[model samples]
Target: MKDRAIERDMDWLVQVFNWAVRFRDDSGRYLLSENPLRGFDIPAELNPRRPIVPRDWMEKVIEAAGPTPLRAMLVIADETGRRLSAIRQLQGSDIQLGRTDAWPHGAIRWRYHSDKVNKDWLVPMSTKLRTEVDRHLAANPVLGDAPLFPAPQNHRKSVSKDRAGAWLLTAIKRAGVQKLDGTLWHAIRRLWITEHKEMPLRERMYVAGYLNRQTMEMVYEHIDPLLLQETVETRREYREAR
Candidate 1:
């Protein structure tokens, strides 16, 4: 397992051990005499940096994903920069196709109940995203409360995150795309965030549903030094004119 994964599991196990220590039976005796794993030192986690998914890699994966629902998920991730947990739980009701004064191209309404931050967000969709969503809806035809991407064996539940990742991995293998550790889904999200670096910080935060500015700036967004230099050079004249 990756260092971060190991660290996370160890932390969770420590919590479990603590809970077991406090657990009492009907006789009011503790279930565990003591937390056996107490004072066990977890290893310091290594840096968990991941590269952004290249546009070519994404194009190849999307093309090779074929008729599967994973294609739609990939497109959404690339376009919206939403987390896999949020994307997988998407329902037909969450999308608003009709144009509004605020959202000319329609919008997506992410609910607080299902969001990782437990906050509601309503953001407008791009024309490309709207078209893709419309096409997916036509093909899958899910209604209110039903998951857009339901499990093949069990329609009652949304497709598991692991299963979705596996599907993406399979597509990656088929497309002959390589490099980086795991979770190409998040890599795609990183690409989306990085691409919007020129946007206002607050607007980008709102669109990406990011509460912590540090994580959004430091983790998700990968700034290109050369690009920044070029941007500054290009805008030098405008700055001088003012």
Candidate 2:
């Protein structure tokens, strides 16, 4: 993999690593946990900052995705901030968890069986995306063990990394993000938590399936876009005396 894609892959791995940490019982998960990847042992050139797709860019990307299941999936991801692992595994049973066509709470649930969070994950489901998803599920009512996204039809029809990347590339184009590097599914997850900074650190960790804040802050420090943008903008208007 090239340097650009390497960062993308690392972002993906970070989410997986985080999940693995959460899945494991207390005792230090692995040797890597204690051994810091920092310091002179690390090469200077590897200290590159990974790029992310701006939220505004995500809007365009969703528009550009054209007509495909991947498009709606990306839209749900951008709005809900779910890991692709959970997003791809969405099913009628999952969506129906504590929701209804009438209530419209704009949140969804992820079952442990199909989640990398490998437990239960509850996330806000945007109104717009839910309409689209519900429509799709309505068409395919044969809710078998398979997920809504692309999975092999054979015995172990799990989602493959290659297919995940392809679906994401299409979303990247639709999102209209210009980057020195590309983004990954996990980046979408980080974007959600980073975008919601004021919501109590622990709550963010629970929402993202992180065992704690130290690890959440470790990877999310560089993502500077805060959840306060709306508040700051509104206050600015008030201060302006218009």
Candidate 3:
């Protein structure tokens, strides 16, 4: 069985077993122990794959999206390195356009509430991204509590993840980029994380809303060969100077 399928089964088993334990004649004697199947390893080939969308491809996708809200979403995802779900849940109130004492380039106070972690985190947006967001907000004024990317059918609600993914797919098609099967939206996030090797690990983790270095390195970080080479050269130069 697939890792996810196994996980689902294990979860269901736990629930059923716990329910039985709670209602049994000898409940104290029927306690469910730790799940033996909790850490089943997924085969590398079966893992959900995310293609690395290069900076040029990202530009093309944005260009294809034009001045639409989708374009803003794409830019924000790339700049913030946030998960698609978190990006979709963004509210107008979360955005702070003008420069702040803490964030000279301006920042977005993103609230991510999920099973992994639930907290409000701030991340600085690039000048270009901030300008784009400002233009978008100016063109389409919304209430502070309204969704940043409001649903077309309902302005009060945020756009569904499926709808956002469809918009990204359309942009990818229009841009003539290779279709990356299951990697369209998420690959952008991966690209964003991968490109920030210059940033300190702790700072990167905080900015990316990651709980630890292990998860960041194992799942998110995709070291670029060119970047690695550049770093190696810099080290060599420093050593020669000494």
Candidate 4:
């Protein structure tokens, strides 16, 4: 079996053993003491790499997308840091365009089933993204229940994930940019998270729909190499002051 599969099976076995121990005559005392996956090292390549998309390259891709609805979709993904699947699944009713007293710039309430957390959630959209979405909606009006980014060939159906990805790839190629190894959409998400590193942990987690700081750190945070020196200098200054 593959290393990852082996690791998963080992983890499952450990959980099962621990549960079985709870019902034993000795109770929790006889539980497995060591992790079954302790020694096995999965290849680094097996893990997901959270790469931040370069802002310049992203701008070029967006420009290459022209005035299509796909461009709006890209902008939303970048501005709001929402998952591509969640963004693609957005319907007209999922967006709120009215001018709220609290937010005069307008706002969007994105309600979608998040594949990552395996749950449905409503997240507040960025004001800029909401404005871009408003423009897209005004230009290409659809029914309340219809998809915001409907398939070009079928108005009733939402754009397929593959088609949306292909659109992005075509734009990337047109802009003379090389595609990153991992999903392009994820790179945009990473870029958003990286840009907001200074935001409070709670607020960042809330915006990204992450349940915990551990998940945010493990899956979302990707510090730019360009900022490494600055980060190190800040840390050094703080330590010296203390």
Candidate with best lDDT: 1
lDDT of 1 by residue, 28-60 (tens): 988788878778878755666677887798899
Error of 2 at 204 (Å): 2.3
lDDT of each: 0.84, 0.61, 0.78, 0.75
Candidate 4, 33: how far from true, in Å?
A: 23
10 residues in a row with least lDDT, candidate 1: 233-242
Q: RMSD in angstroms, all models?
A: 4.6, 7.9, 4.6, 6.3
Residue pairs whose backbone atoms clash in candidate 2: 60-174, 61-174, 61-175, 106-125, 107-125
Q: Model 2: runs farther than 4 Å from truth?
A: 1-48, 97-107, 113-117, 139-144, 152-158, 174-183, 221-242
Ranking by lDDT: 1, 3, 4, 2
Candidate 1 vs 4: which has more lDDT:
1
Q: What is the lDDT of residue 204 in candidate 4?
A: 80
Candidate 4: Cα lDDT at 189: 86
Roughly what TM-score does model 3 have, to 2 decimal places? 0.79
Off by over 4 Å in 1: 1-6, 10-46, 228-242
Give the winner by TM-score: 2 or 4.
Answer: 4
What is the Å distance of residue 20 in model 3 from its true position? 9.4
Model 3 residue 153 lDDT?
99
lDDT per residue, candidate 2, 1-242, as tens digits?
45646556666666665565456456655524532222313223355554455677666766777666667677777666566766776764566534667446555667786555468866656568677776666654526555566464542354565776786686665565663354476666567766777678766766566665675676653446343475566653346555
lDDT preference between candidates 1 and 3, better one: 1
